[model samples]
Every structure is written in C-alpha cells, then in structure tokens.
Target: MKKYFTQLSYLLDSQAKKTIPLLILSFLFSSVLDVIGVGLIGVFLGLLTNPHFFLQKFPDLAFLLQGLSEKKIIGLFGVLIIVAFAVKAILTLLIQAKVIFFCQLLLVRLKNRMMIAYQYAPYTYHLQRNSSYLISRIQDNIGSFIGNVFLPLLNLISSGFIAISILSLLAILHPFITLFLVSMFFSVGLVFDLFVKQKLSSMGKIVSLSNGEMIKTIHHSLHGLTEIRVLGREDYFLQWLSKISHRYAHAAGILVALQQIPRYLIENMIAIFIIGLTLGGIAAGFSISGVVAMVGMFAAAGARLLPTVTQIMSAINQIRGYLYQTQLVYEELVELESITKGSKKIKSLYQKFDKLTFSTIFLSNVNYQYPHTDYSALKNVNITLHKGQSIGLVGPSGAGKSTLVNVILGFLEPESGQLLIDGKPIDNLREWLNNFAYIPQIIFLLDDTLRRNIALGIDDHEIDEDRITKVIQMAQLTEVVQQLPEGVDTLLGENGVRLSGGQRQRVALARAFYHERDVIIMDEATSSLDHETEQEVINTIKTLKGNKTLIVIAHRLSTVENCDILLRLEKGRITKVGSFADVVGISS
Candidate 1:
C-alpha cells in the first residue's frame, strides 16, 4: 500500500500541478453540498417539531417568512437541494474533463520522449529487444497508464475527500454515533482489505503477463500469417490460442471474484449498521422524528462512504498493476552509460581518407560475440578493402555476412580488436555513419508520396530533382512510377504493401542514391528482385565508377563478377579478399 501511494504520488507530480488543485476543489464542492443537504433535512425536522420555531425566536423572522406557507417552504427546500446537486454535477464534469485532458497530454509527452530516446539509444538495445514489445510499451502501455492508473487515482482522491467531509459532519452532530458508525465501516473495510490484498496483487501480475503474451501472439499471428497458411498450421495456432485464452479466463474469474466479495460484504455491513443505529436511537428515548432524521443522515453518509472506500481500494490495486507494466517499459527507455555524443565534429568525410593514404584497409585479429552467446560470431578475423573499392561479401546461410555489415555500419561493437574508417579508429561511429548510406535486405517505406519518400524530408535547398530522376531510372523504377496514378506524387500504402518486393527494393535503392553519401552498403539489397531487375541494379552500380564507394553483399556469385574486389567469409573469419577474377582464380 505504501509503495502504491508512492508510485501514485510520483505519477501525479509528473502531470501538471493544476490538475491536483482542480481535483481538490471538485471534491470540496461535492462534499460541502452533501453536508449542506443533510443540514437542510435537520432544519426541516426542527420545523416539524415546532411550526413557528423561527417565528417565536425572533419577531422579525415573521416578516422574513411572509407569504411563505409550509408547502411553499418545502418546495423552496427542494429547489435548494436540486441546485446543490446541479452545482456538484457541474464541478464533477469540469474536474473529469481536466483530468482527461491532462492525462492525455502527459501520455503524449511520454511517448514523444521515448521515441526521441530510441533514436539516440545504443543499437545493442534494439538488437536485444523485440520491436513489437518496444512499440507496445510506447503506444499501448502509456495509454493504459493514464486510463487504468491515473484516472482511477484521481477518482480515489476525490472520493476520499468527500467521504472524510461527511464523516466529520456526522461527528459534529453526535460524537458517539459518529464514532460507532466510523468504527463499523472501517472494521468491515479492514476485513475486506486483508482478504483481497494478496489476491489482488497476484491477479494483477497474471493479467499483466497475459496481456503481454496476448500482444506477442497477435503480433506473430499477423506477421507470419502467410507462413502459417503455407505450412497448414492453422489448427496448431488455434490450439495455442485456446491455451492462452484458458489461462486468461481463469485469472479473470479469480480477479472478479476477489473484487466482488468486498463489495457485497461492505453493503451488508452498512445495512446492518443502519438498522441497529436507528433501533438504538429509538430505545434511548429519542422521538420517532429524531430517529427518522438520524437514520436518514446515516443512510446518506453510508451511500457516499461505501462507494468511496471501494473505489480507493480498487484504484490501489489497479495502480499496482499499471506500475508493474510501466516499470518494464521504463527499464527499456533508460539510457546506457556507454553511448555518448561525439566529442569532435566530423566536418568532412575526405579529411580522414586524405590522412590515411592507404591502398588497403585492414581488420586484423577481430572478434565479436553477441549477447547471451558463449561462442564468438567472428573469431580472429582478418580482412581488407582498398580505397575507392567495390567489395562483394559472399557466404552460405548463417555465415556472418550480415554481421560483418553490421560491424562496418557500427551497429555492433566488436568484443575485441578494431574497425577502421579510412584508418581512423571508429570511436564515434554514429558521426562516421553520416558519410555512408545503408540499404538493408528488407525494404521499409513510409505511407507517403514517392517524391517525399525519395526526398525524405530534405529541404527545398537540399532537394535535387535531377538526382532523384537519375536514381529512379538507375533502379529500374521508372516504369513503376510511370504506371502509378499520381506518377511521382503517388502515395505508397503502409510498409509499401502496394508495391511489389522488387519495386520496394528499387525504391529503397533510389533513396540511398538520393542520399548521395560517400559510401554505400547494400545488405542483400537485390535479393527480392528478379534476374532482369537485379541485372539493371548491378549495371547501375557499375555506372557509379568515380562517384562513391560501394560494398555489396549477395548470395548469387554471378552478381559480383564485375566487382573491383570480393571478400569471402567462412564462419566469422574472412578467408579471402582480391579482385573478382583473382578470388575466383580466373583470368578476366
């Protein structure tokens, strides 16, 4: 409970401070109206005991009461009661509106911060984590935090204030009666609290775990639908889903049962307390009217207090659940100590190359091991690439071709030895990456126009229409664009689903071309293309003789036949590097 309150306090403080004040004002107004309503009932009771109570106390009261008959007085009291209710309703609405607005604003800020952090986060963080889970944390979990946790907390606080105010009024009216009622209420609450505390926490953990699993399952089902159908595994998937559903149902049932038990217990206790108190008052020589007024006030207080207690208890449990989930997301967002901003600006890519003046770049005694792996992916590897060179890396499946590219791109930090960029140690690889553009095996395009996709938010001053046209032609995407309804302005569907694999790969290639960086790294960039398109793309690469450095990775041996250099990788080690003919042992 203490931990829950601590977490709630931190959450509230993170939101706008004005939210708290509005909540307090809302609670005060509602509680004041409830107490005033009870006071009005007491006044009516006094009037019933003595018709001219006010008239006899002060003669001026008769003038003030002129033209107001008993029926009229009752009607006026009713009007006052309705007005009080209206005021409470208005205040409640405003408070809720403020809470919703503030919670949403806070959620938006949190998501934005996480996104910005992700861009700066170490690549190892992404390599070790699931993209779906990270996406869920930023998009789904933040929303849940606001709705399930923060909103309920605000209600709990408001309800608590109202409950306290009513109890205080009851105490002022009759201390003994107030004490008896308060004790009875808390005793029942304590019993319920004890009964459900552990159970709620346990149920909360199960629900949270189940939620993550469900998301994982759905993500896999969508992404692998084609594979599932091809393999005829529909029944297998359904059986797995049924198991998950069963566990979810079991946990949900237990949670509902725990939640309701307290509600029923509290209600019965309130009913018995009201009856006993009224009977006691009548036996203690109180008039029937006095007993009636006492019972009426007690009932009103109970009505307010019962829901208030239940809501607070429920909110606490929910806060616990949300905090558990939030902690998982928070752990991912926290910064790693290793990543730091580059101390010096790499103003020019040519400066490093000019200094090195070497015909060949070398990686000697290199080693790299992935996290949670005992064996090194690349062990004692040695390799070299010449200046202004085109190198093709070839290997069978799981032969570390992608790993080598990741190392060159500085996406992975080698466990031992060094990676050199133009003979300069790759300490600030992020800064070094500015000189290179990478096209991955899998192409991803935004849901935007072809022109925007190629330009990629580059300013008008930076835009080169001639360059875009040249690359589109080189990538063999001229026909694809020409056929589109809007030509270059045609919007692509999500993930470029509207485009064929070959077309999507060409678009990605065009984007790399438009970047016009010093070095280009293609990781199976043409694997999705057919023989004709691949030939066109290879021809495009050949045309870039003096323009930029090119490093290509391809499974097809014919793809690298015209390359200036070729690097053959066996396991983690680079076994050979030479001109294509020299490596292939053939005269060109």
Candidate 2:
C-alpha cells in the first residue's frame, strides 16, 4: 500500500496533490452526514414504536412535544427524516461526481505527461524497449492503473469512512450487538482476503503479462502482414493469438469471480446473523419497544454497512489484482522522467547560433556497444565528413553500417572517444543533430494527407506550401501527387499503404528535402525505385553534390559510382576509405 501510494505521489502534480486533501475532507464530511442520517432514522423508529419512550429518553424535548399528539409528532419526524436523507443524498452525489471528474482530469494529464517524457527521453531508452510494450504501457497499462487501481483505492478509503461512521452509530445504540457484528464480519473478511490474496495477485500478473503478449502478437502480425502472406503463415499467427487471448480471458474472468464471490457469501451470513439477533432479543424478554427499536437501528445500519464492507473488500482485492499494472506504469514514468530531465540538462547547454557555422564533423576512435551486450557495434571508428561532400558507405551484412549511422545521428552515444564539430567536441547533441536530416531504409508515413506527410510534424497553418511544392518536384513526387484524387492533399493511409514502395521512398525523399538540413543521410533511399526513378533520384543527389553534405549507405556498387568518397566497412571497422577507384579497384 505504501509502495502504491508512493507511485501515485510520483505521478500527481502539485495541484492534484492539493486536491486530494479536499477530497478526503469532503469524504469525512459525507461520513458525518451519513451518521446523522442513520441516527435520525433510529429516532423515527423509536417514535413510531412508542412516542412516550422518545419523550422519556429526552426530557428536555418533552416540553416541545407537550402540545402535540403522537401521530403529529411521528409525521413531523418522518418528514424531517426524509428531508435529511434527501439532503445527504444530494451532497453525496455532488462529492462523487467531483471525484469522478478529478479522476478523468488526472487521466488526461497523466497521458500527456507520459507522452512528453517519451518525446524527450534518450534515444537509447527507446532502443532498449519494444514498441508494443511501450505502446501497451501508455495505452493499456496506464488506463488500468487509473481505473482499476487508483480509482478503486479511493473508493476503498471512502467506503472505510462510511463503514466507520455507521458502525459508530450502531455501537452507541447497542454496544454488545454492534461489537458482535463488527467482530464477525471483520473476521470473515480478513480470513477470506488472506486466503485468496496470493491467488488474486498471481492472476493479476497473468492478466498483465498476457495483455502485453497479445498486443505484441497483434502488432507484429499486422505490421508484418505482407511477409506473413508471402510465407503463408496466417494460421501460425492466428494460433499464437488465440493461445494468448485465452490466457488473458481466463485470468481476467477469474479476477472478476473472486471479487464477486465474497459478496453473496457475506450477505447470506449477515442475514442469518440479523435473524438470530432478533430471535435472541425476544427470548431475553426485552421490552417490546426496546426490542423493536434495537432491531430497527440494526437493520438501518446493516443496510448501509453491508454494501460499504463489500465495496471495501472488493476494492482491496481489485487493488491487489491490478497491482502489477500500477508498478509497471510507475516504473516506466519514473525512468522516462529521469532520462527526460537528464536530456533537458543536455539540451540546456544548447547554444543557438543563427545557423550551423561548422563546415565539418569529425569522429575520432569512437566505440559503441549496445546494453547487455559484450561486443561493440562500432569499434575504433574514425571518420571525417566535410560540408558539401558526398560520402558513400558500402558494406556486407552485419558490418555495423547502420550502427555507425546511428552514432552519427546522435541516436547512440559512443562508449569512448569524441565526435567533434569544426575541431571542437559537440557540447549539445540537439544542436549537432539540427544540422542533419536522415532518410531511413524503412519508410514510416503518417495516416495523413500527402502534403502533411512531407511537411511532417509541422501544423497545417504553419506549413510552407511553396516549399512543399518545390521539394515534391525535387524528390520526383510531383507526378505521384498529381495522380492522386486530392493531389498533395490526398491521404496516404498508415505507413503509406496506399502508395507503392517506390512512391513511399519518394515521399521520404521529399520529407528530407522539405527539412533542408545542412547534411542529408540516406540509407538505401532509392533501393525500392526502378532504374529510371533511381537514376532520377541520383541525378537529384548530384545536383546537391557541392551544396549539401550527403552520406549514402547502399548495397549496390553502382549507386556509389559518382560519389566523391567511398568507404568500405567490415565487422564494425572501416576497411577502406578513398575514391571509388581506390575502394572498389575500378574507375567510375
């Protein structure tokens, strides 16, 4: 419980923290009103059973009732009881509504905060985690934490307050009876909870784990649909999905059953206890009015107490069941927030020059190893990139070409050695990255209009239309756009599923062109295009030969034939660096 409260505290901001006290105070006030309401019903019962008994118990109020007949007094007390209950009901509704609204508002804020943390987190953090896991945390686990864990925790507290209030009133009316009922219910609830505690926790873990696996399976299947179809593995994925979904369903169903079972059993037990109490009171030869009043008070309090106890028990179990989800969300947000703060500190060192004044980037003896890996992805890599020069990188599979590019892109920091800008070490990674634009081998397109995809992340009103048009022509996308129903405004669908592979490459190129950074890195950017379109894109690259720095990684030798410098990489080290003739043993 302390751990979960700590998690909540980490997630809530100052305003939210302040509101908690107010909510607690409101709940306390509502509990007081509950006690008063139940007490009024007890008085009404006593007056109805025997009005003179009420007068005898309260001699001070006997004078106020001297002129009134018993019926009129009973009617007046009934009316007062109705009014009190109505007022209490309205106040309770308002308080609960406020709590729900607060919960929803906190949900939105939590999501927004998580997104911001993700955006600013170190790139290595993303590399260390799976997309599906991260997506599930943000989309699934967070919601579960809020709804199942946090909200239920609040309900548990509210129910506790109400139970205490009702129990206190009953104790004042009949000490022995209230004590017996309280001890019986408490013992039953505690034993039942302790008995099933571990099982509930285990089931919760199964459900949480199953949720992640199911999401991962679905994501992989959908994203790899083309490969799956070509390989005829649809049934394989379907079976896998079914297996995981069944586990999830089974675990979740068990959690619901466990929460509900105690309610019926406890309710039956309460009924038997109440019947026994009434019978025993009569056998004890208690006065008629006294017995009636005692029975009446117990019934009224039991009516409220039973549900409150049930809520408390269910909420406790619910919190236990979904405890894993709370831990996951808490750990993710805390780790991300820590990294985000570190990144912000790094970004704070940013010196915003009007533009990148440096004409060169130099990497000296750089090495990078992925987390938990013994071997380095890049080893003693030394390279120099001059502005306005085209460098082509050629390597076999597992040659660490992409790793080297990732290091240059600031996605991975070198374990040792330095990357320099204009002969000085890079002080700000963001500033260094600002001067480069990368076009990855795999294209990722948003499900938006062609224009928006090209000018990605820019708001519609902020997009420069003329620049978009110019880049579209430069990247050979003008023809494709013209063919669409909405031209540049045509929606591309997710990951550009509407467009062919070659067209997607062209869109990527257009995006790079639109950004117009000082340096452009293309990883097999034109591999999807046919010879004709490849030549067109290459010619476009040739046009920028002396204007923008270009780094191209390609498998095809012919693609780098016209480059000013060629590099051959093997096993995480640069094997050759020279003109095309020097590296390939042939003249261009």
Most lDDT-accurate candidate: 2
Candidate 2, TM-score vs. the true structure?
Answer: 0.95
| Model 2 stretches with alpha carbons more than 4 Å out | 63-66, 344-356, 525-533
Instruction: Give the per-residue lDDT of model 1 (tens digit) for 1-588.
Output: 675555445444345565678667867777787677666655555465555644664577578678899767666666776787677778778767877887888878767766765665667777887776667677767677777677777777777777788788889877898898778767876776777778766776676666666677777777788899999887876777678777878876787666666567777888998899888988999988668767876877777777776776667666655666665545555443123333232223213332223344567677998898888888787777765788788766667888888877667778988777566676544456766777776766779888878877687578788888998997678999989999888999877878876687678778877876667787874445468656744774687655667888887777777677888887887777788887777888
lDDT of each: 0.71, 0.84
Give lDDT for model 2.
0.84
Instruction: Flag clash pairs in model 2.
Output: none
lDDT by residue for model 2 (95-134), tens? 9999999988988888888877777677788878888887
Each prediction's TM-score versus the true structure: 0.85, 0.95
How does candidate 1 fare on TM-score?
Answer: 0.85
**Collision count for each candidate, in order:** 0, 0
Clashing pairs in 1: none
